[model samples]
Target: GDRVLATAILDRVLHHAITINIRGHSYRLKEKLKAGLVRLEETATTT
Candidate 1:
């Protein structure tokens, strides 16, 4: 439930950010968000 909820929230946030703009700052943020998401998924699967 937590994983699903977190992913849904992250998707919504990323979608909103993308709609605003897809420039340098957002690009960097998107990368960081993606990395964090990957780690989250890995941790969830491992545990």
Candidate 2:
């Protein structure tokens, strides 16, 4: 359930970015960085 929801949200955001060209957007950049950090933390904790 969680993976499916995350995948859906990621896909939607990617589609929106491609269609609306959300490059150089501070909000999106911050969000991406935050998500990356979260993934890194998760991986670190797992290993």
Candidate 3:
């Protein structure tokens, strides 16, 4: 009974959800790249 209620609530919540896809370089990582603190290869591996 508890699981059914929880699932119903989750379904209602996700019904109105919107997915956003941000396309761009991160500001912090861009600065780090400029400062030579983080390498491009490092970001590729970490993310």
In model 2, how large is the Cα lDDT of residue 8?
A: 95
- What does the lDDT read for residue 12 in candidate 2? 83
Candidate 3 per-residue lDDT over residues 1-47, each given as its tens digit: 99999999989988989967887679999999999999998998776
Candidate 2 local lDDT, 1-47, one digit each (tens): 99999999999878857456544436654576677744544444443
TM-score of each: 0.34, 0.34, 0.56
Give the Cα-based TM-score of candidate 2 against the true structure.
0.34
Q: What lDDT tens digits, residue by residue, belong to model 1 across residues 1-47?
A: 99999999999888857455433434544575677744544444543
RMSD of each: 11.0, 9.6, 5.3
Residue 22 CA displacement from its true place in model 2, Å: 18
Each prediction's Cα lDDT score?
0.62, 0.64, 0.90
Per-prediction count of colliding residue pairs? 0, 0, 0
C-alpha lDDT of candidate 1 relative to the true structure: 0.62
Q: Arrange candidates, best lDDT first.
A: 3, 2, 1
Q: Candidate 3 — what's its lDDT?
A: 0.90
